[model samples]
Structure formats: structure tokens, C-alpha cells
Target: MNISIVLILLLAGAAFTFFAGNKFASKIALLVSVASFVFTLYALNLYLNGADLSCKSIWIQNPKIYFSLAVDGLSLAMLLLTTGLLPLIILSGWVTKFENEKAIYSLVLFMAFAMAGTFLAADGLLYYVFWELALIPIYFIALLWGNGSLEERKNAILKFFIYTFGGSLFMLVAFVYLYQKAGSLEIESLYALALTETEKTWLFLAFFLAYAIKIPLIPFHTWQANTYSKAPAIGTMLLSGIMLKMGLYSVLRWQLPITDTAAKEFMPYILGVSIAGVIYGAVLTLRQKNLKKLLAYSSLSHVGLIAAGLYSLTIEGFQGAVLQMLSHGLVIVGLFFVSEIIFNRWNTYTISEMGGIRSQATKFASFFMILVLASVAMPTTFNFVGEFTILYSLYNVNIGFAIVAGTTIILGAFYMLRMYQQTMLGETNTKVFADVTIVEGLVLLVIVVLVFFFGLYPKPIIELITPSLQNILNQIN
Candidate 1:
């Protein structure tokens, strides 16, 4: 079967899960997601064994649009990340009760469909459609199923919606402009356009606005912490684990190639902002008392470094960015799941309210400690591999930039360790903190194992993504 089958299965699963009703909705959703993941693996095998996975068809003759989908090493890696995490995301919420549980599960699958589409679509307009489609499910997921006071949730969700939606309009405008000038909206056509520096600069900034807000870089990131805090664990997982990657992916896939000259011209400034965000996010995390918000801010810091690597416009930079995206996605989900487990036990997210769980629940604490170390980029974890590569790329650009960005490791370790101490260490809590349940243990184990496994032997992933990154670098150069 073609790669499109992955999308078809997920969209179909969403519909079936919605109709399956609440009693079996989660199970159905999990099954469908797993099926899609398996299909994606089959697709990857086909791709690896020298098969062409791209498909294209006419949609709008006048605008010259096509229902196009393409797969290469880069897109395949993202597809794997998306499909791989979906089953875990589903399982993370398995026991949590929600209003209209079937609907929640349905939305999750639908979001997956959109995300997979976003990764696969090769036509510019088609990509835009999938990009915006992803926002709808998450909006509802956060709005309806999120926690916090009604007004707080409403305000946070609205801000996130407005920021992302507004930013995307600029990207849409860029796509329209590209279509007008190039007479086609396919990615290759946009890349081929011989635009003037002035035109390329405008187009680059427009696309950057969309991606930055989605990546939520710096000033654009105001919506993130509150939204992460307000949303339920599952919603937060989908957002942090998969959604933000769309923006970073787009940077490599769409932005830099289409605006290569402009990207080169603006590299220094953009790198400055990204490195600044790294420090900014890490510092902010140091002050957070709320567990979710702290993790949220930490994500901001990590992604900033990833964005910097992409902007560095080197092969190592691209590889590091992709690797970190996967590493961060898995580790963040595990951390959020841990936070959810704590919330389930204590019914609170306040850091000061937790302590000494290590004494009672060694398994839970061990899992958490591993995830924490991964977050801090411990030597043998995937995070270290990704972060070291990224820092090395930055050092190639400017030693000062590398030096500044390196602070993330130290600052990350400090705040992350401090947060771990307050939340998982200290005297034993009076409340009984049970060890991880079987399902929870399985989830954490998978994440931790993958983290270390990739860290130690990154050859396969490096080899998988190298050619795709080299192609993008060629386009940029």
C-alpha cells in the first residue's frame, strides 16, 4: 500500500472511534493508532528498500494545485515520530475520565491524521490545509477537556488559537504570492522561483512568523505556558510531543529552501533570537512552582536550541535538529505523564506540595530520574547526542553563540535537578505515593529505553535523515 494509507486509516479510525461510543472508544482509538503506526513502519520499509512513496494528483486545474504527498528520509522520520507517539498518547489518558470520552479520542485521532498529512503533503496549498487542520482538533481538545477555571482555560486557549491562526494567515499569504509568481504551488516550483532579494525577504519573514508562533519562539511564545498548564495531560502531550514539531519541520521543509537567500542574509539575527530564547526559557523555568508550567517553559528552551541548529544551515545542524525533535518529543511526553501521575495521586500540580515519593515508589522515581537526566542532556541519553551536535553546529557559526547556547545545558541541569529535588526528593510525603502501574511503567520504560538506545547508537537515525538534510542544504546553498 501507498503512504496515503496511513492517513486514510487514521481518519477512518477517528470516525469509527467517535461512533464506537465511550465504553470502547479509548480501546478503539488505541487500536487504530497502533494500526496506523504499523502501516507507517511498512511504509518506512518500502521507502528504505528503494521504493518511491510520493503520490500526486490534480485537484484545482486553474490554481495548479494537486493532491500531492511525498516521502523522503526527513518526512519519514517525522511520520515515525508522529505515529509512534500517538499510541502512547492514547494510552497516557486511558484511565482518565472525560466528558464525551469518545469525542475526545476521536479528536485525538483526527489530529493525528492532520499531523501526518502535514508531514506528507508536498503541495504548498495542500500543506497549508493540513497545517491549519491540525489546529482545530487541539483547540477543541483544550477547550472542552482542559482543566483550570473556565475563564482561565478559555483565555489561554483563545490566546493560543489567535496567535497560531493569525501567524498562519501570513504563511497563507506567502503561499498565495508564490502561486501567483510561480504559476504553481508545489514545493519544487516554489523552490525554483528566482525571486529578488526583496521579495524573498518578505516571503521568508511571512513564513517565519507562522512557524515561530507555532514553535512559539520568544515573544511569540506567550501563549504556551498557560495553555500547557490549562490543558489536560493528553492535550498537552499532543501539543508538546507532536504539534510544535510541525513548525520546526516546516522550517527545514518549506521556509529555508524557498527563501534560501533571505535565510542566509538573516541567519545571524535569527540565531540570536533563538539562542536568546534558549536562555530565556531556561531562566523562566527556574521560577515556576507549577509542574506543568515548568515543563512547558523547559520545552520552550529546548526547542529554541533546535531552531538555532536549523538556522545554522549546516548538515550537522539539520541532523541535530531532527534528532532533537524526536528526543524532545518522547522525553516531554514521559515527563508530562509523570506529572499526570502525580496529579492523579495528589490532585495537585504545585511543586512544594510534593516530596519523598522516591522513598516509597522506587520504580516511579527511577523512571522520573531517567527522564529528568535526559532533559538535562545526560551523557548517555538521546538528548545529549542531539544537544551536543546542535551546540557543535552553533560553535561552527560563532563561538560566542555556541558559548551562550551552551548555558542551556548548565541552566537546564540546575533547574531540572532543582525541580526534581523539590518534586521527587525531600522527606516522604504523608500521602502514600504508589509506584507506577503496569501501563505507566510500560510507557516510561519505552521512552527511557529509546532515549538511551538512540544516544548510544545514533547511526541508523543519522544515516536515515542525512540525505534529506543534504538535499535541503543544497537548496539553501
Candidate 2:
């Protein structure tokens, strides 16, 4: 199957949902998400069978780019992440009382469409366009549907918008510069670009600025907590669950090979920044009163280590990062949706106001406990394998770096257990507490099953991803 159909279906789905009116829009969107996901699985099978899935048409003449799209192991893994979470995202949105339901539903499909394009793009300008295209739908979703005072919402969304948009401009400049240097924006052509050490360093920083701000690494991460806090829960899922992976993916795809010498030159400092962010994010999570902000901060800590693994430049590191990206994407969607469920039932976001959910909702507590353990990288969950691989890679790089980064294990446990205890274990704060409805249970059950399934046997993904990372490493050399 041509992967372009996946993009076309998503875009078409968006338009159809926009005009389908309120009553049917959400259902149509969910159906479309599921259908696209099935096709992705087909595409993955075709790819493994040695069928060619890459296709391109001339997109521009003078600049020499194509509307090129292709899927490799790396791209397919990320594509799975995008397509897999989408149905769950849509399912979670079903509980939301969105104003202008059609617009919101349509925007979501548009976001998925753009992210899918990003993973598959075989051309740099095409990748950039899709990258920026993703920001718009989420922008409106946060600004229009988010819960906050109008001014507060505006401030948070705008910071997120401006910070990310500004970073994207740098990435555009780096691409443009590379295009001018190589006379082509095709991924392979740029990968083969010959630049002086100085030029590559500049390109490295330019791309890093973009990916860091998007990933919101460390100080660049100021935008994330506020934005995640204010955005609607569905939007939060898109951001944490999938959007953030774009940076880690970009590091593997764009920054690492293109800036090989520069990356090696600055490897110590770069890894230091990443390790610092891990500690920084975990520290901040300890004090958050708001549940969304806690998850947002926790995401930072996890991604910080994931980014560090990619920087470690080992196949095991890359393999673990890719798997963790998928695992984190699944777990975060369940986490945010749980927070949303809490808010839906109790009308509160503050931790102090939550308690005794376990007393009434054993099912919720069971599922929630699994996710909490997953976040903390417990065995028999997907995250444990990924986290182990990453820490092992870091240990190879430097024991001290590994030690610092390992703090996430402890810190993740600390905050997650505390949050679970305060929210689910203590005395009931209100009269009513309900078990997860069927839809919510269904979504989280998928997450739980996948988490365990992958952890027990991650060999398939590791084998698929290792060759791609090897290819990238070959390019870097």
C-alpha cells in the first residue's frame, strides 16, 4: 500500500468530520482513525515483505524537491505510534463537551495527518512544511477549547506557539542552508552534504534550537507545563503522547548524521544538558499541585533521558529510545485521560481535593496502578525494557552521566506513587466516585495490554529499528 493513502485518508477524514455536523462527527472521526491504523499495519507488513512503499512526485522545479514520502523501520515505528494512539485520543475526546464538536474533531485528524507526513517525509522541505503544519491545529485546539481563564489560556498557548514556531524557523533556515549547499532537499542528498566543520556546527545548533524547544529540553521547556496545563485533555494527549516524539525522532533523522562532527565535538556538553533536564524535570514534578502539570513535568523527565540515549549514539540506545517513544506515547495518553476522567467526575484538578477513588472504583484503581508502575518503569511493562536499555547505553558513555540520569527511576516512582496515594488511596473527599465507564476502560485496557506485550517481547521492534539506526550511524561515520 502506498503510504500516501494514509495521509489522504486523514485529511479527507478531517474535512468529512467538519461537515458531518455535530451528532456524527466524533463517531466518524473515531472510525477514520481506526481505519487509518489498520492500513498502517498493512503498510508495515508490506515493508517487511520487501515490497517498495516509497513514492514521490516532482513538487517543485527550481529548488529541486519532491513530494517524496517513504517508510523505513524508523519511520514505521513512529508511524505506529501516531496511528495507534489516535483512536484512543478520539475515544477520550468522546467524553469531552467540546464546543463546535465538528471543528475539534476535524482539527485532531488534521494534526494526525501532519504528524504522519512528518515521519514519512523523504524530503527536507516537505518535512519542514508538515512539521509546521502540525502546530496550527493544536494551536487552535488549545486556544479555543482549553480550560482556563481567557487571559491565562491565551498566555499559555501563545508562549507554546511562539516558542515552538520560533524554533521551527531555525530548522527551516538549516534546511534552506543545506539545500543551498547541496542543491537538493532530498533526505539522502542532504545526508551526503559536505560542509566545513564550522558550517556543520552552525547547522547543528540551528536544528538543536528547533528540536530542543519542541521537545522543550530544560530551560527551553518553560512553555510545556503551562501549555499542557491549559490545553484541553485531548490536546494534551496529542502534545505529550505524540508531538514531543517529533524532536527525538528529528534528532535521529536530521540532527545526528547531518552534524556528526559537531555532535561528537560537543557530545559531552550535549549529553550534560540532557541529563540536567532529566533531573530538573523530575525535581519540578515533586512540587506540582496540578495533575496535568505533574504529568507534563514527568514527561519532560522521561523524554530527557530518551533524548540522552539518542545522543549516546549506540544501537541499543537508539533501539531503546524508539521503543520508549512508543511506550511513553501509549502511557501518557492513558495518564492524561485518567486525569481527564478525574476532572470529569469531580470537577477538580488540584491534588489536595482528590482521594478515595480506590474505595469506589476498583477497576480504575487497578488500571491506574498499572499505568503508575509503567511510568516508574516496573518490570513486565514496556517502559522497563526501554529504560534499561537507555541506562545501559548511558553507562557505557560515562558512569556519572548514567548515575545522574538514573535519578528519573527514583523520582518517577516518588511522584507517581505520591500522586496515586493522594488521589486514589486516601479517604473519600466527595459523595460520588464511579468506576471507569466502558469506553474509558476499553482505551486504557489497550494501553495496559500493549505495555505488557511489548515489554515481554520487544525483539520485533528492536530488530526492525536496529538496522535503521545502524544506517544512520553509517551515515554519521
Candidate 3:
């Protein structure tokens, strides 16, 4: 089966959802998400079983770009990540007490479709269109339904929208240059072009500025903490879980090949900046009392490691970065949702103000404990595999870098455990508290089970990524 149908199906689902209203919106959304997940699985099977599914249709004949969609090992991996987490994110929001649930539900489905389109689009212009399209639904979601003080939330959302869109302008410039140089706007055409060294360097910087802001590497990270902290739980999940990967994916798809020499030349400085982000983000995480702020900081630290991994330019490093992206996406969904549960119950997120929850709900405490351990990269969790791969890559690149980056493990444990202890281990500060509902328990359990499952057997993903890594690395020379 062709994968482009997935995008068509998703769009149909979004339209159906918009008309379905609140009563049927949730059920319709769930069904669509399940179907999308099935399609993702089908695509995976095609990829692994050696089926050919690349299809292209022209959208802008003048630009020579097509509404192209392909399912290669790399695109398939990202497609799986996009479609897989979506149902879970939708499920999390299914239980949320959102106003105008129909609109919210429809928007979620739309965002999923947009993300899937972004991942699968093979034409440069088409990909950028989907990339920008994905941001619109999220902007409204964050601005209207987010949790912070209204003015603060609006400011944060505005800043986030502006910062990312502003950065994307550079990407557009880079793409225009490629179209000029390659004589076609197709990504493959651009990949095949042999640009002068000077041209490659300039294009690389343009792409780098765009992605660095999306990844929000240290200096460009000014907007992330506030945006994440203020966004609604599901909005935050979409931002951290799937949106950030867009930037990283672009690095592999466009940046690396377009300017392999530049990547090699600037590896040391890029690596150093990434490590600095790791240290800087972790230190700030340790100091945060707000649950959301802490997670935001932790995200900074995690993405820093991924960035470093990519810059290492080793097969292991590239694979590890991909694994880390998947791992972090899952863990952050749980982490943010857990915080949402707490906010729903107690109406506060301050660690210092919460206590004695172990008695109130052993289930809550237990689930929190599992997520904490996973976040800190306890040996048996999927996070451990991500960290191990990244650190192993780092060790090969530079042992000192790995050692310095590894300190995040220590700091991660300290903050997570300290938060757990303060929030769940003290005397019963308040009598009224609720254990996780059955749905909450089931959600947490699934996440925990997957964490352990992938941790124990990452062979599947490693094999899936290896061919793609080899393809990319072959081009480096």
C-alpha cells in the first residue's frame, strides 16, 4: 500500500472531526488515530520487508517541486515516531477537561496530519509548507487553552511563534538558493548538486540558524522554558515530543549532505557548544521548583546530547541520536502528563507546596517513581539505552566530552529524586488527595512497559536505523 494515502486519510479524519461535534469528536478521533497508527505499521512492514512505496506528484510545476512522499528507512522511522505518539497524545487529551472539546479534538488530529506530512514530504517546498502548517494549530491551542496567567501565556505563545517562524525564514532562503543551484526544488536534486565550497558554507549557515533555533540550542533557547511552562499539557507534549524532532530531522535530511565539508570543519565548535548546553540546561534544571520548568530544562539537556551525537558524525552517534529522540519523546509525554494529572487534582505545581502523596495514592507515587527512574536513565528503562548510545558515541568522539555530559545523569537523578521525595515522601500535608484513575493508571502503565520493553530489546530500532545511517554516512565522503 502507498503511504501517501496516510496523509489523505488523516486529512479526511480531520474534516470528519470538525463536523462531528463534542459528542462524537472523541470517538471519531480515537478511531482515526488508531487507523493512522495501523497505516504507520503498514509503512513499517513495507520498509522492513523490502517493499517499494516512493510516490511523487507535481504540485508546483514552475518550481519543479512535487507533492512527493516517500517511505525510506529514515522517513519510515520518523513516520512511525510521528504516528505512534499521536494516539497517546490524543488519549491524554481525551480525558482533559478542555473547553469546546470538538474544536480541540479536531485541532489535535489536524496537527497529527500536519506532522505526518512534514515527515514524509520529499519535496523541499512541500516539506517546508507542512512544517509551517503544523505550527498554526499549536499556536491557537497554546494561546487559548494554556495554563499560565493569561497575559503571560499569550506573551509566551507569541514569542514562541515569532521565534520559530523567524528562524524558518532562513530555511526558506536556503531552500531558494538550493532551487537555484540544483535547478529543481526536489530534495533529491538538491542532495545531488555539487555546490562550490563557499556556496555550501553559506547555505549551511542558513540551515543551521533555522534548525538551531527550533532545537533552541543554548543561545537560541531563550523562548523555550517560558513557552513550555505556559503551554497546556498536550501543547507542551506536542512541542517537546514531536515538534523539536522536525528541526533535528531537517539536519539529517538537508544540512548534512548539503555541506558535508562544513560539518566536518565546524565539528569541534559545534560539539563544544552542545556540551555547554548540556551543562547549562542541567544546572538550571536543578534550581527549578516549578515542575514544568524542570522538565523544560531537562529537555534542553536531553536535546543537547542529541545535538552532540549528530555532530560526532559517527554511525553509532547518529543512531544514538535517533534513539534518544524516540526515547525522549516517549518519556516527556509521560512526564508532562503526570504533571497535568497533579495540576488537575491539586491545582498547583509547586514542589515545595506538595507532600505526603504516597499515602494519598500509591498508584500516583508508583507511576511517578517509574517516570523519575526513566527520566534519570535508570539501567532498565528505554532512556538508559538512549543515554548509553549517546555516551558511547561521545566516548568515541572524546572521552572528556562524554564524561562531562554524563554528569547530567547525576544531576538528573538528584533533581528527580529530590522532587519525588519532597512531593511524595513527607508527612500528610493535606488529607484530600486522589489516586490515579483507571485511565491514568493504564496510560502510565503503557508508557512504563514500553520504556522497559525498548530498554531490554532495542535491536529492532537499531536494525531499522542502521541502513539509513549507512546511506547517510556513505554520502559524507
Q: Could you tell me which residue pairs clash in candidate 3?
A: none
lDDT of each: 0.94, 0.93, 0.86
TM-score of each: 0.99, 0.99, 0.98
Per-model root-mean-square deviation over C-alphas: 0.7, 0.8, 1.2
TM-score, cand. 1: 0.99
* Residue ranges of candidate 3 with Cα displaced over 4 Å: none
- Per residue, candidate 1 scores C-alpha lDDT tens digits across 1-477 of 678899999999999999999999999999999999999999989888999988889989887899999999999999999999999999989747788989999999999999999999999999999999999999999988888888898999999999999999999999999989989998888889999999999999999999999997998999999999999999999999999999999999999999999999999999999999999999999999999999999999999999999999999899999999999999999999999999998999999999999999999999999999999999999999999999999999999999999999999999999999998899999999889888898888999999999999999989999999999999999
**Candidate 2 ranges beyond 4 A from true positions:** none
**What is the lDDT, from 0 to 100, of the residue 108 in candidate 1?**
99
How many backbone overlaps does candidate 1 show? Answer: 0
Worst lDDT 10-window in candidate 2: 425-434
Identify the superior model by lDDT, candidate 2 or candidate 3: 2
Which candidate leads in lDDT? 1
Per-residue lDDT for 300-393 in model 3, tens only?
9889999998888888888988988888898999999998888888888888878998988998899889989998899988888878888999
